[model samples]
Target: MKNDFDWKPLALVPALAILVFPFINSGSTWLTLTVAGLAMGMIIFIIASGLTLVFGLMDVLNFGHGVFIALGAFVATSVLGAMGDWTGSDQLWRNMLAVLPAMFVAMLVAGAVGLAFERFIVRPVYGQHLKQILITMGGMIIGEEMIKVIWGPAQIPLPLPTAMRGSILIGEAAIEKYRVIAVVVGLLVFGLLAWTLGRTKIGLLIRAGVQDREMVESLGYRIRRLFVGVFVAGSALAGLGGVMWGLFQQNVIPQMGAQVNVLIFIVIIIGGLGSTGGALIGALLVGLMANYTGFLAPKAALFSNIALMVAILLWRPSGVDPVTSR
Candidate 1:
């Protein structure tokens, strides 16, 4: 294994931030936009992480991943709705008591559904990329229909907890409380993932399995089980992300996941598919690009990320850091 670290890709986040600082002009607006962009990027990373994990380790193309996202969000609406007193409270701690449990329930449900999804929808199509893509997309459509049935076809409000609403002033810049929380949560998730995938025995085995499945299996480890666990975990992460995304939008809809799917793919592709670190960088870049462009040129907001993706590809055709190349 190569022991050298590449600081270049990592620097892109700050470099991009500095590059856009001047165009944003006002210090307050820049600060606000930067925080918002980072929060958005973090949420995107959470959603994309699971699909990337499944693809990297299991080599399964799960186009249906968005279903878990919507599922989790809808589930949160129910959970938070039921805990109205907790969520409605003015105390942040009280609000968290409700939100945390909602997150947990969402993850649990999404994971259970993911287990079934893998068994019924993904298993037969293994190693067939074309079949995986078509079938999994079909699965997503069905999953969306199921969501509409459970949550109704109408959009549902997912208001933030009382304490999480509004903004806290940082100098002249006003930042939403939830956005700050989002940035912290995203950082925590990234840190945990980096540690889990790099420092532990399971991480070692998973990496080894990806590189040489037969070798790992010959050593008496159940590679199949590991892959299944990864799928479930990935689904759970997506569910957690769904809860966050729903709150970020302050609403829940059956098709929300499908809408976010476009951004998720862009992030992973930019990050060099299946690379978590790359995903973070890709997500942040996307978030920053979207926010900056949206503020500067509203008309170009829609195509900004697409343009950004093209630029990145032109520079690194295989992505910022493809796992295969690593």
Candidate 2:
């Protein structure tokens, strides 16, 4: 059981990367694009992980998750706007002081909204997925309007802090410092999730509830409460991802989250609905494929992930490692 987490699917990431390298030919260019892809994939994993737990444990299909992402990025704007001095500084430490607080505030606000969303929109159609999808989508539409009202419909520029503004050269390859940071953050998140879910009692209960909710309830543990907690945590992670994505793009718009929602869904489907490990693998593959395609054929960049998803689905329709099967 300890070794139940499969590592075989992860090989696709490196395999894909290696396969593309021969096409690119230039070592430095390949390295640069590969790192960029990995960075993007890690950011996606951060956002998708929460949904994985929510769906895996609660069977809740929340289409409004994008709202939380937009909220988090907007919240970061306010927090960072107030700390202009820190973000404007050349010192990395000062920038972190501003960013760390913004991240906290974004997570807090997103998590709070998640609670209300659970109470109102999601709670009613607990088992009706069709209603859940329709209502949650409506929730997203309204949330976008609300965001436009608060932040204005115009795209707000979210500049990188001075400390992370440029790239470092590594043997003719330029790697952005922020991208490396994203990779570290993603690894940390994955490690934390693996530890919490695989090594802790609470994690045990969560898994137990997922497998059989009634049994856990009969044992005096409240499954509803756990589900709520999962939703909040998932929302918080989406918020965290929002902040990262905003910084990555150096701009924020009300629809930014919705635009990303497509990719998130692709990752979920590719990863087999509720599997975290599968999500990571799928995300990395997507990121790599997008970059490779963009460089090799710019026109195909927009549909690269979609194409990858379809290919993956055709090969393994249930996903690379479907949680339902496990």
Candidate 3:
């Protein structure tokens, strides 16, 4: 295959384009676009991180993950709104402080929901792809309906604390304070996850289980407990992503999760199934492509993302999967 089709040259195209994008569009517009892309990518990464874990470890395609995110956003918004009314200040500090606990609560709630889902919905469908698909899709529908019923099918505005509402001046450009915070939080989460997975005994067990579940079980490891731990953790991460997105974007809606589901799948597909690093790289690529494309063609910015995905699929059907044989 290598002799028949050279893939290395094709791989360089995206890298080259990324290097050249700044030179082509050098201005405030470029900076704004870059920042927006980075922000969006961070959001995607947060959501995708949980997704990659589930897919990698459990081999489960969870359509209900989006619901966790939407729930987190709404939960944080409601809590902060209540705090604002109580304080009568509507200042940044109150809102920021309020959201910290709200996010934690949201994570806890999301984890419980995920645990129930695994117990009642997912346990029976293990090793059965068709059943898993049907059950998960049903879960998605039920989750969406629940969100609509509870939230009233309208978009809710999340109050951004005053501190997060402004932009910071960096050399010649200004970046949104909230976006910077989001990026920092996203990186922190990423780093922490990497450490947990790379430097811990549980992480080793999880990795070994992913490679050989039956063997792990035969070795006396409680696979069921591991699955539950991973599922709950993944849901919590999705919830955290939702909270960050709500705080940064200042809006929450019932369909927000549904709207981003397709793109989330695209990120996972491009990143490689089960690889967190690939998800991160793929998300950044997609984010930057969407932003830079706006400079070249404002109306068709999304087209660039689609085009990149198509090119990737055509060149490497296995995504960023590293295994190759000649």
Candidate 4:
């Protein structure tokens, strides 16, 4: 990593935002869209961060990661469903009480499942990219079927808590309250990840393991265990992201995770194979592009992100900030 911060990639967010401002022509509407885009980006980052970590550190592409996402969403549905009183309340703090527990439980359940997934499904295919892809994909299918068995094959509503249902006016722009919360949660997750990867001893060991596993092991550290930990953490993050995504859509389907897999892959690829910072940039750009294009040309909304990825890859073949260690 460079000693000094690279501001160029950071600048792209604002630059893109500025470039689109003129086309929107309406300040208030533009503001609303920008915020919404940011919120969506953050939720995506939360989900993608785990996969990036797992790939960056373990070099294991667990295609079944989406299963964790779906699991998390379904778990949150049950948790929130049981807390009808709190969700039904108009008090923000009260809603948080219900939401926080749901998030926690979802993470816990996902992490446990991740542990087993690593033990049985992913461990054997370590370092075999082809097998990893094939097996993990099969795992995802099994997971989706399991979800259907448990939650049924129908779409279920996952509405926001009463206090989070409306928008807050800022000047002439209206920002959804849930979007604001999503942004805050995303920022917090980012900050924690940054601090852990940059400042902690465990982080040092993990990064070192990534660069030279043998060297790290020579020092008596168990890099394999650390790698497993990374996998579980990644799975847990996916779960958290699932919960956020489910709420964002206000509905959950058995195949939601697989459907989201496409965007998740796009975000990670654009961010570079395993780069955290790159993922954030890629996600925000995707979110913004999707929103801007959706508003201007609704039909293009589905393809905007694909176009953005191609543009990004064309400009920086390996992504904006690929982890060079790999």
Candidate 5:
């Protein structure tokens, strides 16, 4: 009976509602929440994409992924600040161009960190779940403390370019340009990732590895290289996410990575650990839920994600596992 029903249309309902909700509740708060939710979901996608790949392909649970994000944000912020000082203007184009170098540097640093982690830390503990969890948690703590020490405890404001500081009128609703940029960037990244995974040789190898690591290894494939590659890619993605979040939130703090760690976990779990499509869908769902719930219960915004997590667990313990025949 379940096979007889179409799920594609059901999936579209959420997007449809997002478009129509503004008409129903055109309040500044609602509009803002909608935009914020969209922006947050995009950020989640950026981080979760790499995470899902690593977990799904390499079977590694990396708790320190949040650290990569925090590091990326800090590096980007520092670069932008320096650029602003040199250029003497916070113009949108200048800031945007400045972010390019920041992104590259952040990704390189994050990738190097991941490589070192895989070589020294994660290598010995491969397949040892308990040890992996313990070591990764310790790494997370170290990352958080390092940020506090280096950047201090205060929240550092990330300066947005003057042009991107305002909003645009969409019908009667005012939407922030930064939010628009976030959505556009998110879509482009997702699309590119989808294309690469679907069409590229390495992507095929990764998917094949996810299905059966032993089989791929037996075929003379260098599983270790693939694992390292996945880890580096994942870390780089997290770093990019941090940079984007810094721009969107306008603050960089030591504990910021810790704060978002749970949400990213929930997103991957809800979306299915190994599936990119699942991550994207889950992020959007969680994002919208958090935004809508915050409207009815501003104080309860913290619990919104938890509630969604519980619901997803109750409904599908395997998450959105695409291979599962439900």
Candidate 6:
């Protein structure tokens, strides 16, 4: 399948931003909200991208994807807490030194746990969608309980490092420094995934396997192992997202992953279940709609994404670009 970049759907992000701009009136406020929405969307994309990959490539329901997210957040909290001196430092580099490790450790730990999860909870239910759903959700509940056992049943504060705590003045707008970081990171992730999937041998194998498992397997490439690797990578991405999310909220809780699960699902569904580009587009839309509605009509904020999803599905039930094909 040659490259068929569905650029039309991407118009939605800028369109939404532009549509909301007039209502916001002030340029600075509009920019501020737009930046914030992008940041939020990036975080959501980080979380949803993994599940999208798994569902698209491995065909696993993975309802427990959120557990990996929560695990990553909690792990980051522990690592960051131990590095008080670095977090307390006002220097941006020093703060990043601390955060970089926290993010790394979070991803590593979460990915490791995901390996076990795939082995025990998910391996048995392969190709069984209903069983996959039931078992993976059970796995998440169990993982949550384990989190409570280790981290306690309370929310733990995840304070931003000193240099990243405040906002940078962008003209009349006050955009957060961390939010800027988030945007950059999100872009980097998207770029990396795009390059890997579009250019690399491994990515080629994964995509081929998705389209025809037997064809790839016949070529002496263990498709199952490739999928396992994909699942692990997805889990790591979720873990990375979890760290960003924890810092974004300045707190962590056992249920945080489960809480965000709905948003994640909405995102993957809105974007084709397997398309990385779609996930990015969907996440940005959801993020923009959320911030816009939250500010415009606070009471209606909760239903905004659901309404958005409904609207999107009404238009394209299979999602923006159902990558399940090519």
lDDT of 4 by residue, 219-313 (tens): 99988899889888988999999999999999999899998888889999988876777888888888888889989999998798898889988
Q: Go through the candidates in order and give each one's C-alpha lDDT.
A: 0.89, 0.89, 0.75, 0.88, 0.78, 0.90
| lDDT (tens digit, per residue) of candidate 2 on 57-165 | 8788888999998999999998999999999999999999999999999999999998998999999999999999999999999988999999899999899899988
Model 6, range 127-153, lDDT digits (tens) per residue?
999999999999999999999999999
Candidate 5 global lDDT: 0.78
| Residue runs of model 5 more than 4 Å from their true location after superposition | 1-24, 27-32, 85-91, 321-326
Residue-by-residue lDDT tens digits, candidate 3, 236-281? 8888888887776678888777767777888888777766666776
Better of 3 and 6 by TM-score: 6
Instruction: State model 1's lDDT.
Output: 0.89
The estimated TM-scores of all candidates read 0.96, 0.96, 0.87, 0.96, 0.90, 0.97
- Best-fitting candidate, measured by lDDT? 6
Model 1, span 1-326: residue lDDT tens? 32222447978888888998988779999989999999999999998877887787778888899999999999999999999999999999999999999999999999999999999999999999999999999999999999988789999999999999999999999999999998899889988887777788897777666566788999999988999998999999999999999999999899998899999999888988667777888888998888889899989986999998999999998678676665
Report RMSD (Å) for each prediction in the order shown: 1.6, 1.4, 4.9, 1.6, 3.7, 1.3
Task: Quote the positional error of residue 179 for candidate 4 in Å.
Answer: 0.4
The local distance difference test score of model 2 is 0.89
Model 5 root-mean-square deviation:
3.7
Which residue segments of model 6 deviate by more than 4 Å? 324-326
Candidate 2 residue 239 Cα shift, in angstroms, is: 0.4
Candidate 3, pairs of clashing residues:
92-161, 92-162
TM-score attained by model 1: 0.96
